[model samples]
Target: MSLLQSQVPGNLRLRSIDGTERLVGYSPPTRQNHGVAAVVGFEEQELLRDIKRALLRGVLIVGGGSLLALGMTLLVARRFIAAPTDALLQAARRWRAGDLAARAPGAARHSEFGQLAGAFNRMAVALQQREEELRHHAQLLEDRVADRTQALREANARLEAEILERRNTQTALLQAQKLQAVGQLAGGIAHDFNNVLQAVLGGVALIAKRAGDPAAVARLTGMVEEAAQRGQSITRRLLAFSRREELRADRLDVGALLVGLREVLAATLGAAIRVEVEAPPALPPVFADRGQLETVLVNLATNARDAMEKGGRLTLLAEPVTVAAGDPGGLATGDYIRVTVADTGAGMDAETLARAGEPFFTTKPVGRGTGLGLAMARSFAEGSGGRMTIASKPGCGTRITLWLPAMAVAAEPAAPVPAPRPGALPARCARVLLVDDEPVVREVLATQLADAGYKVTEAGDGAAALALLAGGLACDILVSDLAMEGIDGVTLIREARRARPALPAILVTGYAGDAAALAVGQRVEGSFTLLRKPVTGAQLADQVAALLGWRETV
Candidate 1:
C-alpha cells in the first residue's frame, strides 16, 4: 500500500512479476473498507501490445473492407458513368462524322448514367430526325430549283422568238408605208401627164392626114407616133406603179416573148453583161397581163444588170411546174409557167435578202436605184395570180423566180382588123356629139368626126353637153370626156340616157379614177363603150360607123 502511494497520487509505475514494466492506478479509500484503497494495474508493454494488435486487426479489416468497397465503386463507376460516357463519346464521334444513325449503348440500365444515356440517345434521335428532315427538304429544294431553272429557260426562248417575229412584222409595216407614199406620188403625176399625151397624139394624127408631101407625111408622122408611143409607155408605167392601171389578161406565148426580149435586154444591159434566155419551144402559155409581164421582166433584167457591176452572166429560164396544194409560196394548185432570172454577180447577204421585196429597200447607191424594182415585180406577179421568190447568199449569186398560172388550152389570138379610114366611111351621115373640157382636145375631135362624114356638135364640158341634149339636140351618138368641171361624163350619160334610152354613148377617159367612176355609175349592160385616150381618127370613125351599123363595102 505504502509503495502504491509512494510516487504519484493515483498512478504508479512498477516492474511486474513477468519482468515487464507496469502501470497502475489507485482509487482513494472506500467507505465499506474503512480506509482500504482499490488498485487497477496493467503491464504497460502488454497493454500497448494488445492495443497495437487490436489496432492492427481493425486496420486489416477496415483496409480489406475499404478495398472491397473501392472495387465495387470502381465497377459501378465503369458501368454507370465511364462505360456509358465512352459509348456516348464514340457515338458522338460517329455523329460528328455525319453518321446520324449512331446511338449510345447501355440505355436499358436504371442508373443515373442510364438516364443520362437515355437523354443523350433521345437527343441524338431528335438530331437525326432533324437531319433527315433537313436532308429531305434540301433534296426537294434542289428539285424545285431545277424545275424553275428549266421553266425560266423555256420562257426565255419563247420571249426571244416573239421578239424576232415582232421585228419582222414591224419591218413589213414600214415597207407598206413607203409603198403607199410612192403610189400616191405616181398616181398624181400620171393623171396630168396622160392628158398632155392625149393632146399631142390627137394633134399628130390630124397633122399627118393634112400633110401634102407623102414622104414628109410618113417621116414626120412616124416620128410623132414614136414620140407619142414613148409618152404613153411612160404614163402606163406610172399608172402601173401606182396600181391604178387596169390589167388586161391575155394568153401569152411565153417562149416567143422571151426570144423577142433577147435583143432588147442586150441593148439595155450594155456590152459588158451577157444575157442568156432559155425557154423550151413547146413551153406552155401563161394567162397574165401582157404589159405587166413585160414590165416585170424588164425590171428583173435591169436589176440583174445593176447587180453585175463587174460584168457577169444573166440567165432567163422558163419551165412548166406543177404546184401542189398548201404550197409555201401561197400559189394556187395548178400548172404554172415558172420563169427564173438568175445572175452570177454580187449577191445579197442574209439581212439584205430578207428585205429584198420591201419597198424602198435598196443596196444600190442613191439615184442609181428607185428601190421599187423588186417590190413592183412582186406586186405584178401576185396580181397575175402568181408568186415570186428570191434565193440568194453572200457569195452565191441571186435567183429570182416567178410562177405564173399556165392556161390549160390557149386559143390563137384573132388578127386585129384595120380600122376604116375617114375616106372609106359610109355615105349615110350619122349625127355626133363630142364633149371635152379642153378646147384644143374638143376642136381636134370635132374636126376628126366632121372629116369622117359625121355632123359634128361640140360642147366644152359635161354640163354644156347635157344642156344641149336637154334642148332636144338630135344626136345619134354621144362621146364625152369622163372628167369635167361641173357635171361629169358619168352623170351626163345617166341624164342623156333617161331622154333617149336607145342612145349609144362613148366615154373616153385618161385617168383610171374616172374610168372607175364611170364603171360605178353605169348599171345598164352594153349601154356605153369606153375608149382609152389618145384615140386615133380612124379608131373614132370605125366606132362611129359601127354604132350606126355602117360597114365599109368592098
Candidate 2:
C-alpha cells in the first residue's frame, strides 16, 4: 500500500503474483499517469480514473440543468401566482377591516386572477350599497312610527278635552234648572208660610185675651200648636222639592214607600186628581234615599196634575224585573225594581219626549214650571245606580218608569229606643251647651233651655263653643248648629269628644240635606244625632232630656 501511495498519480491499483489483485486506492496528484502505470497495469487504472471522471462530470451537468429549471419556475410563479395571491390576501384583510375602497392592484392584469379581483371588488361595492339602502329604509320607518305616535297622542288629548267640556256644560245646565225651580217655589212657600203665621198669631192673641179662662187659653194654645205644625209641614215639603244634594242611599220596600206617599200626592195634586197605587207585596226592596224618592213622586204627580187641567188619574205601579243587556233605558244587566208612574193627561210630542230629561226643558207655559222636576228625578235615579225612562205619545198618556237597583240583602234598621215622656223627663238641673251662629237663634235657644229649667250655656259660633269646651266647662248635653264661622258642628263634636268621649250631642242644621247626602259619613267619627232647623221647643226639650238619660220630674 505504501509503495503504491509513493508511485500513484490518481486512483492506484496493484497486481501480485499469479495475476491476483492485492491493493486499490486513490491519490491526490491525479495528473501523474506515469507513476500510476508503474504501480499497476496502465489500462485498468486509467479506465477506472476515466470512469470516475465521467461520473463527476455527468453529476455536475445534471445538477446545473436542474438549478436553471428551478430558477425559471420560481420567477414564473412570483410573476403569475404569488404576486396576485398576495395582493388578494392584502385586499381581503383590508375589506374585513371595513375599508370598502381596498382593491387588489393586479386587477388590470387581464388574467383569471385579475378577473377574480375585479369580481370581488364589485361584490364589495354591491354589499355597501345594499347596507346604505337598508339604513335609509330603517330611518324612514322610525320617522313614520314617531309621527304616528304623535298624531295619536294629539287625538287622545282633544277627545279628553271635549269630554270634559261636555260634562261641564251638563253640570251648568243642571245648576241653572235648580236655581229656576227654587225661584218658582219662593212665591208659593211665602204664601203658605204667611197663612200659617196668621193662624198662629190669631191663636196667640186669643190666648192672651183669655188669660183668666184656663179652658179658653188651653184651646187657643192647641190652635197655635196646630198652626205651627202646619207651617213645619209646608217647610218640609219645600225643602224636599228644592234640595240640591247627593243621594243618601238606604234599603227600602218600594210598596211601603209608595203607600206612605199617597197622602202627600193627594194634597199636592188637589181634589181633581186621583192617585192609584198597585205595588205587589212580592216587590223587591230597593236602595235609594227616602226623601229623594218622595220628592220624585211629588214632582211626577205635580207634572201629571198640570197636564190634566180638568181631571186625571195617576197610577204608581212597582214590580221586580230582570233587565237584560241593551235594555231600552240603557240600564245595566241586573235585577232591578221597576217603578212606573202613569198619568192620563195630555201626552208629550216626540220632540218633547226626546228632550224630557234635559235641564229646564218644559212643555208647560213659561213661569208655570221651572222644568227641573223631571230632570232632577232622572238625575237622582242615575246617581242611585238606576235609570229613568219616559214613554209618551200625542193625545195619549205618559208613563215614566224608574229602574232602581234591588238590594242584594234586605235589612231593617233597628228602631230608635222610645224616648221618656215629656212630663217624666228631668228638665231641671241638666247642664246644656247651646251653639249657633245667628244671634237670634242663639238667644232663642238659650232662653228656651233656661225656661225648660235647664242650666244653659250659650256660644254664638263653633269656635266659641270649642273654646268653651277647651276651658273644661262640663256639659251634660251638647246642642250645636252645623254651619258656623270657624269649626263646624261636626268638627266641634269630633274635637269635643276627644275630651268627653261619651258626650251625647244634638246637631241642629239648616244644611240637613247636605249633611245627610255627604258620601264621607265615616269621617264624622261618632253617631251624633241630626235635627233640622226651626226645631220646636218641645222637640228641643225632648232631644236634650233623652240625650242626658234624665227623665223630666213627673
Q: Write out the backbone clash pairs for model 1.
A: none
How high is each candidate's TM-score?
0.52, 0.53
C-alpha RMSD by candidate, in order: 30.1, 16.8
Off by over 4 Å in 2: 1-179, 185-246, 253-284, 289-336, 344-390, 405-428, 433-478, 482-505, 513-530, 550-554
Record all residue pairs in model 2 with backbone atoms less than 3 Å apart, i.e. clashing.
424-551, 424-552, 425-551, 425-552, 426-551, 426-552
Candidate 1 residues 412-432, lDDT tens each? 799986665655535348789
Runs of candidate 1 exceeding 4 Å displacement: 1-212, 247-283, 288-306, 310-336, 348-396, 410-428, 513-515, 520-526, 550-554
- Write model 2 residue lDDT over 1-554, tens digit each, in one string: 45444544454456756675545545433355633434334446555788999999999999999999999999999999999999899989998998877777766768999999989888888878887899899999999999999999999999999989866765666566456545535654666677789999998888889999999999889888887887776666556545643446777888987885674566556668898999988677788897788888877877887888889899999999998899876888999998999999999998888898887677766446657789888998899899888999977889999989997864779998886665553556788999888889889888888888889999888888888989989787789888777788888888888888777788887754756553335656657778887787778987787666643341
lDDT of 1: 0.78
Q: How many backbone clashes does candidate 2 have?
A: 6
